[model samples]
Each structure stands twice: as structure tokens, then as C-alpha cells.
Target: MESVRTTTTRPAAWLMLGIVLVALNLRPSMAAVGPLLSAIRSDIPLSFSLASLLTMLPVTAMGLAMFFGLGISRRLGERRTVLLSLLVIGLASLSRLFLDSAPPLIASAVLAGIGIALIQALMPALIKSHFPDHVALCMGLYVTSIMGGAALAASLAPLVLLHGGSWREGLALWSALALFAAMAWQMQGAGSSPVAAAKAGRESFFSNARAWWLALFFGLGTASYTCVLAWLAPYCMEQGFSEQHAGLVLGFLTAMEVVAGLAVPAIANRSRDRRGVLGGLLVLIIAGFCGLILSPHHLGLLWPCLLGLGIGGLFPMSLIVSLDHLDDPQRAGGLTAFVQGIGYLIAGLSPLLAGFIRDRSGSFEGAWWSLTAVMALMLLMVLRFDPKHYARHIR
Candidate 1:
């Protein structure tokens, strides 16, 4: 039963700007913390294991939220929902400045993650519904801005402290960015109105084995991403890089992701079968992990460069692959939402897993090796993503 569905859209440039700026807000609250973990721990008595919650809590919230986020947007409408999410994020980020202990800090991170999840849930439909002709371009822009925000926060936070500011300030200043985005969203809110949605079928996503595979694939790939995002700076610090330099490496790595996010989709657009490209990216990831494990000091910069190129490409590609599984935007959105839901729940554990490994082994080597193996597993999984299976396996 296809019921009437009404959705409002306008193709103005400000809406595009709104999308990019909002995308920028999604990552900084989480990304800024990794480099400063050493500092945060110094003052707050936060162990590596407990500190993992900074990343894990938010990501876990995001994963859990994806399942219900679309419904929230429908009831509240996307515009107001986006505004509310932004304020939640801004207030959460602002709260970090006053927080004195681990629990409050982590709670704020979860709040920020919920905010990110709410906006993330609505963004694809908003972009696709409004910028139908430019869905690909807008998506690429959205993904890249996410990376760009990480890059900015990672690079800037250390610089702030290096110049004599407190780490709290470094973490909390991102609230200002969220505020700016909130204002921009308010201005563009009228243009991108409520989505007229019809009730989707009650079919359980859990019943689908193919959906599980895609979810696992996306989950494992994200594990690698969130692990690095949470641990890379601290790992580099363990490598004896200066605090500033370690943050820079993480920043550069995320910047490379921004570059790859844009380029990978364009390159993959020329070929329907993305397995070959996926394989190549996995090889880079494996090699980068190898370098990080074997030689911590020599050619240190090269490792993040390679890892950035590989992981960056893989993230967007994972979503693209899931999207490839179905042509209908509505169906693809549902499939991708299901994938991200389970995938992020799986991804959220990685940082905690890495932190636990560190607590046990006294080094991050075990986590790196585990991640390397997982990437290799992903390499093998690519062969299964053959385009021929898409239609047969879906709908």
C-alpha cells in the first residue's frame, strides 16, 4: 500500500551551505578528544579504558539512535529536529568546560553523539529529496565536511593548549561552531520543510541475512575508523611524537580522509563493480597497520598518510556499496540505516577494545594486529559484493 507522502524541497545554494556546515559539526566533539586524551587523563584521572568511553559512548548512542531517529524527525519534522539536535550538541559541548569528572564528561559525549545521530539520520533523505539532481555531489560534500571538521578539531585543539589554554577550553570551543551551524540551519529551515512520509512496511530488518552481512561489513570497517579516530593521536604520542605533532598526524590523517572521500566516489562512479577498488584500499590499510606495528619512529609520517588514504576511501565506499544494493532511495535509506545501526554498535566497541588491550598488554600492538586481521577479512568480503547479487539478494 503506497500511501500519499509529501516532502518539501528547494535547490537554493544556502541549503547546500546549510548541509556542509552542519556536516562539519558532526565530528569535532568526538574528534577533538583523541589528541588531548593524554592531557584529559593528566588532570581527570581517566584511565585509558575509561577514556575510551569518550568515543565509545557517543558512537554507541549514534548506533542505537539510528533505529529510531527517522521516526523522531518525522514527528518533529527535519528542520526543527535539526535545530534541536544542534542545540543539544552545542550545549553538550559547552558543558565540557564545567565538567570535573569522568562520568559527566562521558555523559556529555553521549549527548553530543545523540545530537550527531539525529542530524545524520535525516541528512540523506534531506539531501536526496531536495537536491535530487545533485545527490551524489551533495553526499560527497556532506561526507567530506565531516572529515574536514575532524581535521580542524584534531589540528586545532593541540595548538590551543600549546599556546597556554586549558584542554577543557580546547574541547569546549567546538560549541561555538555548533552554534554557528544552528543559526545557519535556522535561516535555511523554512526552505527545507517537513518530509511527507508514508508508513513503511513492518518487515523486520533482522530477518534479512544479506542486511546482516552488509551491517557487519560496515560495522567492521567502522571499527577500524573509530579505533583510529579515538586512538591515533595517543598511539603517535606513544611513538614519542610531541603532543602537537601527534595531533597534527591525526589531523593530517583525517584531512587525507576528506580528500579520499571526494575522490573515491568519483573514481568508483566510473565502475559499477567496486571490488577491485575496495581491494586496493584494503591493501593500503593493511600496509599502514604493518608500518605502525613494526616501525614506530622511522618514516612515521608515511604510515598515517597511507592509513588515511585507505580508511578514508573505505568509509564512504561502504555506504556507497550499501546504497548499491538497492536503487530505491527509500529502500536504500532503510538498508543503510539498518547497516549503520548495527555497524556502529559494533564499531563503538573498538576503542574500548583497544583501550582494554592497552591496559592488558601495556601497548597498542595487540589492537593494531587485530585491526589488520579484520581489514584482511574485509578484503575477502569485497569479492562477495559483486553487483550481480544486489537485485537477487534485495527486495
Candidate 2:
């Protein structure tokens, strides 16, 4: 392949916009649904377990789809895959507008899951390739957008339902955002050179331990994110709050995550090694859990803020670590897919297990217990990770 220069500032700006737009769409479909799951379940006359499954289905599909994303990204070109994914997500999200039965609703979930998985798994690699110098900033920006999207969707979906008439209209509103993202991506794609496109196909990234580590860390971190977004709203309502208030609280938590998610990792990256940063985040996570259990109603704002902060740090740190650990951009992409694939798999189960525990125990305490234990395990993994040397030896 002929050589090609790195992307220029004009193209980079467009890529950045595309990244933010794509990231924004990733979480809304998943997070928005949780805030309304109970209402949807009641309206459809389905079991609580079924409601939980609807939430779980997308996450599971996300993980499952990530398992093959590197190859898919290679085949389609990362830009094309992302653009296509956005289109699929938009269509799937649009499908909810016509849903008259449980099966179609579930199909929407699955379609959104697949689209999200493709984007999530490939985003790290895309960032590394397009913004190698500004990865830390880019990571922060992308994650903040993710939390912002979740917060907006969480609060707005129910409001839309109340104001716009039905749950279908509420859910379908996000599809417009997804469509906007798809358009942005297509615009960015027009600037790519033939050499860049060819090189993308030649680059391979799915066969190393570094890839596995990235995938694992991403998986673990996202598992926490998924758990929080999926169950927090329901937990709030279950604790005697009204649905509107519950949705607002969840929105607030997600908004707090946007701030932390943007700031924490950027701060952590200032250090030579990030183990200390990781350790600190784990401590905060532990504190967040304690807050959740002991002073939930009283502390309210503080509790979710702490959890959001912890999650924000964890998610972006994992992404930053993946980039830091990989020498090649393609390897970064491969590792991203691996980590997200596994991370999403783990994430997919959090809501389901939480729901099952809640159903059986008649309380949300079990969910907290599960989160605490996962946080502990994640702490160990982050502590053991030696990002500086790990990737070179991973082969």
C-alpha cells in the first residue's frame, strides 16, 4: 500500500464530532429504557422478569456482537462499520414506535444492542488511530458524551411519554439522534483517502494477550456502567419514590457521571503510572456502595454522585489503559473489541441478576452486594495491571 499522511486538523475536527455523536447514541437506547421499564411492563402486562430481560437482551447482544467486531471493522472499515451501526441503531430505535407486541420490542432491543456493540468495541481503536496525541482528552470527551446522552435520555424519555402521548413516541425520539449521528459519520467518511482505507483492511488486531487485557478491563468497567444505568432508576422507585422523581434522580446520577467521566481519567493520566489512580477509584466505588446501602434516601444526591464518579473513572481509565498498553493502533482496535466484547458480556448480566435477586429476595440489597463484589474484583485486576510493560510482552 502507498503511504498516506496522518489526518489533518480539518478532518480530525470532523472525526471528533463523529466520535461524540456516535458515543452519544450508544447509551441512550439502553439507559433510557431502564427508566421506563416498569411502566412498559405494567402497560404490557408482562412479568417483572420479562421487563428485566428486555433490558438485559440488548447488553447481551452488545457483548455477543463485540466478539466479532474487530473482524467486522476490518472488513467494513471502522468508519463504515460505525456509520452502518448508527443506521441500524436508528432503524432499530425507530422500530419501537410501531411495537404492538413483546417480540417486536425485544427485537428492537437486540438490534440496538448489536449496533451499540459495534460502535463501543471499535471506538477505542478509532480514537487511537485518529487522535493518538489527544487520546486522554478524547477519551474524556467521549465518555462525558456517553453519560450526557444517558442522563438526557433517562430524564427526557419519561417526560416525552407524559407530554408526547405514548411510550413508543418516547422511545423513538432517540432514533432521531442516532440518525443525526449516522449523517455525521457519512460526512466524515468522505475525507478518507484510498490508502487509508486500504491500510485499514490490511491491519489486523485480534490475536494477542494485550487484546484480551483491554477487552477484560473494558468489559469489567462497562459491566459496572450497565448495572448502574439498568437498575438505578428502578431501585429508586422501589425505595418509595414516584416514577418521575426516580427518573430525575437517575438522570442526575448520569449527569454527575458526565462530569467525573470527563475529568477523572484526564487527571489520572497526569501521573506516570495509573495504579494509584485505579486504587483510588476502587475506594470511591466502595464508598459509593456504602452510601447506597446506609443512607440512600437521606444522602440521595451524594450517593449516586459518588457511584457516578467511581464509574466515570473506571470506564475511561480502562479505555486509556487499553491505548497505553498497545503499541500498534490496529492492536488497540483488536484489544478494544476484545475488552468490550467481554466487558459487555459481564455488563449484560448485571441487570438480569439484579432483577432476579430483587424478585427472589424482595429487596435491592443483593444487587448492591453483587456490585461491591465486582468492584473488589475489578480493583484487583486494575492493581495487577502494569500498563507500561504489559503490552510489549503480550505478543
Each prediction's RMSD to truth: 2.7, 2.7
lDDT of 2 by residue, 190-223 (tens): 2333433344335445566556666676666676
Residue 75's C-alpha lDDT in candidate 2? Answer: 61
- Candidate 2 minimal-lDDT segment of 10 residues: 190-199
lDDT for residue 188 in candidate 2, whole number 0-100:
64
Model 1 lDDT per residue over 6-61, tens place:
23344367787888899999999999999888999989998889999999999999
- Point out where model 2 deviates above 4 Å: 1-5, 190-214
lDDT of 1 at 85: 93
The models' CA-based lDDT, in order, is 0.85, 0.77
The clash count for each model shown is: 1, 3
In the predicted model 1, the residue pairs found to clash are 6-196
Q: Model 2, 200: alpha-carbon shift in Å? A: 7.7
